[model samples]
Target: MALAGWICLAGHLCWMTLQCRSVSGKVLEETYTKWLKYKDDCLRQIQQDPQPAVGLYCNRSFDLYACWPDALPGTTVNISCPSYLPWVQTVQHGVARRRCGVDGQWVQYSEGELWRDISECEEDQETHTEELWMKQVMLSFRVLYTVGYILSLLSLLAALIILLSIRKLHCMRNHIHANLFLSLILRAVAVLLKDSLLDQHWSKPINTHADVQHILSHRAAIGCRTAQALMQYFVLANHYWFFGEAIYLHSILITSVFLDNSKCLPYFLLGWGTPLMFVIPWVVMKLLRENKECWAINENMYYWWIIRVPILFVSLVNFLIFMKILKVILSKLRADNKQRYPDYKLRLAKATLTLIPLFGVHEMVFIFATDEQTSGIVRLIKVFVAVFLNSFQGFLVAVLYCYSNKEVKAELQKCLRGWWRWMQTCWEDQ
Candidate 1:
């Protein structure tokens, strides 16, 4: 029953793909058709070839990716690089190799997989240089974000510990901060897990004997898709939690009388439950329309917008609330600063700094911007800035709301002093 349902779903997706009217959808359909034609030609060639008459000869076959021919045991067969792939232009003169083992079967790349060694197909010097440079850039970006997230994760964990452990710090604001910290921690973890599951080097398909119809199945591993979905959920939660923080602050400033009885339940729901509204539909869209390769590539803008639009909307709302809060704060500061202007200035500066992270107003700069539309140094700079902002945001928030908060600092100091006195007293008694 389950298999039948999956077949029906797959048939529906194929029907949708064929009937798609968008230019990108048409291109995708054309590419798929071209691959099917190529596979048919390979299979035809394999069928027309004379069958092996005796022992010690590997059979002719098509491995869904490339065609293999009958060969003597222990001999390697070489074929021209396939022309169907986009990268084939660079490797026009290149060859793909596959080995036949002494046991009269195609030699396995691993215990259960057969492979064509396509390394030679990527040996063009000029193309290799370009790819190498791009790979180095990617490696640098990955390393930078990985380190930043690890630091942020560790810092946020410590902040959560402090906030949860210290009873004196228990308040609505601190509780909200703890939720924000937890969301950021989960986002970092999701990002790391998604990266690990879908990294190009690790997730690249192992060529094996399989039908062309199942090629996408090999590429789109369930684990990577699940990771991608989890990443989306956590990322949305992180943004909406920023929205929740803004709402919390706005309420405290604008509706102070209601604060004592306000519950964290609503904020929790906003932070965690709301992402499902966007992510579930986005996942369904990907599965039905653009199901390929870890759900990372944005093939259809409309489907991509399903997730991007909500994040932008939340950020914009947060920004507006932040501006209103700032205005109210400045007005109050002016009215209250008749006697102590310097202290007022300091307090205002602290408030601005503190609210910036809580509201996540920094995202306003590049919220509508994308790196893909740029080139050269502009693209590099945009990517770097985006990564730096995204990766270090939790760390900055933790520092502002927990590590550097005067209230938290005072509590830590008081705790340290008591522990020190206890140690001294025990020493004297001993």
Candidate 2:
């Protein structure tokens, strides 16, 4: 299952990367074309009525006459003045020209060929702007891609550890494992697609603002929505599995009534299938509203909110139910004089308590904290907090429920010991 998950994740990542590259390329092409058109318009306007004396500024300090011999289109020309400053600026039509000489003293360029210098300055400015924009984009891409890649790799390692800990694949852990794998795969793909290949290919020129917006809207609306829905579904399934774990513990530890009910069939379906019913509405709404971007709340915000409210309410209810079951199990253990089980119970309780506030109540806070009236800094902080909390939920569950369990720890240690002995024997033989 873990291997399967990794394969799926890789495939999705490749697809998303390709899609992003394609979209980015289209955007960049459109932008460049628009910029070309703007440049052409400017040139045409200049030809209609040439200015007598155009002053070009260099690096905000030096103003000089811009004059060139030839009318070159789609090329850059470098002109040298008495100044050695490494900055340049241009003004198309003006009389006041400033200049800095080699001595670093400011002077005015009252006479000289102005048109050529202005053209060169404009060309250099455009080039510099493009380079700066590309550098900014590349920096953003590196950070996003690096973080995403590391997380995906670590998730794969965690999955492998889980799979190797058990002898058989069909177990409670396996069910949770499947959900985690699916989530990691989809998220990795989404990240890779958005950050890497697509962004590189699609460089939007300034004039193609509408096209860029259109592409961004479509990608955010459709691509991001699909990814978000999948993530939410997987999260819901994983939590359901945790709830199942609690139920199984209750049956075995407190009472034997549900021993037979702990089988994988019903739990498996409920874990994977139940979220679909809730998710269907969002998917249908997305398709129907197929606007530029996917909105959390659309034209029928009330209707959508009504649907979402129940899901949130149910999650809280299930959390409460899990807590009650946990309390009962712990009480029973304490009465029976089982120290080990009671300690385990305490751990489970702590995990549940932490999660309830983290996932359930925190969401409400996030919603309330967001407002159009809020200052930009406050809004930014609120958004960051919400996103961080939401992502943290999945990771916390994996750590607290699976990695922190004594039973799981023992099994993992045994597996590692065996593997270590095997490696030792092989080394000795060699």
Best by lDDT: 1
Per-model root-mean-square deviation over C-alphas: 9.4, 13.2
C-alpha lDDT score of every prediction, in listed order: 0.76, 0.47
Candidate 2 wrongly placed segments (more than 4 Å): 1-157, 168-170, 177-203, 209-260, 294-299, 329-382
C-alpha TM-scores of all predictions = 0.73, 0.51
Cα lDDT tens digits, model 1, 1-430, are 2132123323333333222213223333344566568779998898887777767798887665566788999999998876554456677888889888899888775556675677766536786476557657866887899998999999999999999988999998898899999999999999999777655323233232132234346354588789889999999999998988888888878764322327888888888999999999999999899886567667678888889898999999989899989899988998888756757778888899888889888888767776446777777778888888889998999998899889999998898899999999999999
Deviation in Å, model 2, residue 227 alpha carbon: 3.7
User: What total of clashing residue pairs does each candidate reach?
Assistant: 0, 25
lDDT of 1: 0.76
Alpha carbon lDDT at 312, candidate 2:
63
